[model samples]
Target: MTTQGQRDPQPAGRRPDGRSERARRATRTLPAKALGWCVVVAVVAGGGWVVSRPHPGDWIPGLGPSSADATKTPPVVGNPLPPTDTDPEALTADRYFPAQRTIEMGGYKGKRNGARQGQDCAETLRARDVDPLHDTGCQGYVTVSFSGIDHPALLSSVTVLRFADDASAAKAAQALRAQENAAAALAFILPDTTAAPAPTAGAQQPRVEAVGHYLTVTASRLTETHSASPTAGASSPGVTAGASTAGQSAEQQIEAATRAVSYAAGAQFIWT
Candidate 1:
C-alpha cells in the first residue's frame, strides 16, 4: 500500500519515467550518428567541388597580332598601297647607266665554246645580225651596268629568244660575233637549262629582279641610275663590293648566268 504522493514500482525492462532507459539512450544516439554522417558527406562534397573548380591562369596565352580569337577581333586584310609620287621631274635615273659595255650570258642553250665564252659569244652572235630584232634566232639579251658601290656591273636585262631551232640560233649568234667589239666579248655561263612550262592565261614566266642603290636588273630590263647614296664618293665605303652575301666570288655571277642559259635552252628545246 502506497501513500497518495508516492510513485509505483517500475515494470521489468521499462524505465520509471514511461520510456525504457535503453530506448531513450538509443533515441538520443541515433540523432547524433545521423548528424555525424551528414557532416562527413558535406565535407566530402565540398572537397570535390573545390577540386572540380578551375585553377587560376588556365586560359590560353595572348598572341597579340597573331591571335586567332574571333570574338574580340576583326577580320584582317592586307594593308593598302601608298600613293605614288606624281612629280615628273622628280623621277630619278638609274645611276649605273651606260653599262660597262659588257656582255652577260644567260639562258638555256649549248655552245661550241666553253661556258665562260657564252655571254660574250652570245653578244657576238647578236651583233652580226643586221636585223637583230627581226631576223636573229637568238632568244634573249642581257645588259649589265657598272655599279661603283660594288665594283661590278648590275645585270639588267634578259631577253628571250624565239628561234625555230638550234641551227638558226647558231647562225644568229655567229652573226653577232662578227659585230661585237673584241673588248666587249666576255662569257658568263649560267646554270643548266631548266624546262619552262607553257604559259597559261594570266601566268607569266618566273624571273629574277636584282636591285641596288644605283642599279636594277630584271629579266626584261636592266637599268642603271645615278641614285643618291648615303656615302658620297667615299671610295672605300664599308659595304663590300662584288661579293655576294653568301661570300661567293664575283665569278660566281658568271657561273650562275651560264647555268641559267643552259636551263633556259633546255626548256626551249623541250617546248619546241
Candidate 2:
C-alpha cells in the first residue's frame, strides 16, 4: 500500500513528475519560446513603421526637397498679352510690348541691314561675349525698349532678329542656350536671357526662341522679381492684360511677356 504523501509510480522513460522527459523539457521552455516569437513580431512591425514615416514637403517616404531646390527661386508666371503677328521688317515699337500706359523714348525700332543690325546690338551682344552680327549670324532685328517707363521699374522689351538661313537660326539658338546655361551655373540673380549681361541690374531673363529663320527674344525688367520659366506663352486679343496677372507678382508679369512674345513671333511666322 502507498502512503498518503507518496506520488504515483512513473512509466518507462518518464521523469519523476510522471511526464515523458521530452514533454517535460518542452513544457519548461514554453514561456521562453513564446517570448522569442513575440520579440520577432515586434521587430518586424517596428521596421515597417519606420519605413512608412512621411517626409517633409512631400507625401512619400524617403523623398524630400534637396538643398538646391530650397535655395532656388520659385517658378514665375509670365504676362498674358496675346501674341500677335508683326511683319519682320515692318515691326513697330508698339507691337513688341505689352501695351503699357505710355511708350518710352527710342524704345521701339527695327533694322534691315546686317551691318546696321550688328552695330546697334553690339553693346548687348558684347555683354555676353558674343558678337551680335558675327556670332549670331543675325541679318536684321526689331527692338522695343522700356526706357523712361513710369512704373516700379523699366522692364518690358522684345527683339526679333531674322537669320539668313535655318542653319544660322539653329546656331544662334544653340549659342543662346549655352549662354543661358552658363549664367545659371554662375548663380546670377538676373533675367534668363540667351546670355547674361555684364551688369546684372540691366540684365533680364529673356525668352529666346528660333522658329524657321527668325529668332525672337522677349524680356521684362523687374523691380526685384521672381518667376518660373514658361512652358508655353498663350495669348488672345480677347484676353486682356489685366486678366493675365490680376493678382500676380512682378515676376509673373516678366515671365508672361517673355513667353507671349515668343509665341506671338512664332505664330506670326505661320500666318504670315
Candidate 3:
C-alpha cells in the first residue's frame, strides 16, 4: 500500500498533479510571451509619436506633416488700409488744382497745361523717381505737366500719390523729403511743343507732404534743359548759375510765385 505523503503515479502524457505536461508548459510561458508582445507595441507607438512632432529646423519632410506656411504662425498683416477705395477716382488732381496759376512775382497770371492720372508711378513719374514710390505701395498717381512759367519765371508741376494707408503716405513723404533716393518728384510731361530752356532739376526743392492716405510731391521749377552740362554749378552753390537760373530772377518774387502755384494745386487735399 502507498503512504499518505506519496503522490499518485503519472499517466504517460500527464503530470503527477493531474494536469497534462503540455498544458503545464503553456501556462508557465503565457505571462512572459504576453509581456514581450506588450514591449514591442509600446516601442512602435513611442516611435510614431516621436516622428509626428514638428519643429522648425528639425522637421522631416516626407516622414510626416511638415510645412512652414501651413504649420507655422500666421504672417504679419501690419496696419494696412483698403486698397480698393484708394483708387483716387474722385479726389484726383484735376478736381482741385486751378487751371490758372497766380503769378505773384509781377502780378501776372500763368496757365496750367493739363493733368494726367495713372494707376501707378510707372507711367506718371520719371524712371528714376518711379522706383522709390512704386515700391511703397503707391496706388494712385496724378501728374500735371510743366506750367507756363517761361523765362524770368520758373515752371512748376504737381504730383499726388495715394498709398494703402495714411501711415504709409506719411512715411513715404518723410523719406522723400529726406532725399533718401534720387526721386525728387513725378515726371513732368512737357507740352506738345519742343523742349524748353528749363532747368535740369527743380528750381525749388521738390516739396513732399502727406494728407490722409495721400502724398503730394510738388516742384517749383522746370525739369528739362537745353544745356548739356546742367550739373556744373549744382555741386558748388557759389559757382556759375546753370541754365536753370539763366533767365529766372534771383529774388523771392519768382520763388514765392512758383510755390504759390504748387501750394494752390495741392491745397484741396490738406484736410483730407
Best by lDDT: 3
Best by TM-score: 3
Model 2 accuracy (lDDT, Cα): 0.46
What are the per-residue Cα lDDT tens digits for candidate 3 across 1-272?
A: 67999876677998657899889999999999999999999999998788776533343632543455344322211122223643434544334543323334354245555566656455654555345564677776766544433432235556777777888898888767766333334464444212234344434566677878787776554333343333323323333333334444443434554466656655666665
Better of 1 and 3 by lDDT: 3
In model 2, what is the error at residue 107, expressed in angstroms? 23
Per-candidate RMSD vs. true structure? 23.2, 19.4, 21.8
Regarding TM-score, does 2 or 3 come out ahead?
3
What's the lDDT for residue 186 in model 3? 48
Off by over 4 Å in 3: 1-89, 98-108, 128-130, 146-153, 180-185, 193-203, 222-248, 251-254
Q: What is the RMSD, in Å, between candidate 1 and the native fold over all Cα?
A: 23.2
Give the clashing residue pairs of candidate 3, or none.
none
lDDT tens digits, residue span 1-272, model 1: 88998888787889767999889999989989999999999999998776666532223322222223223221211121122232111111111111111223432112111111121224422233334324543333333212222322322123223243555655544543453341122222212222122223432222322111111112211112244233222223444333341354434543454345334333322422
TM-score ranking, best first: 3, 2, 1
Better of 1 and 2 by TM-score: 2
- Predicted candidate 2 versus true structure: per-residue lDDT over 94-165, tens digit per residue: 333322223322222111111112223343343444443456666555444432122323244455566667
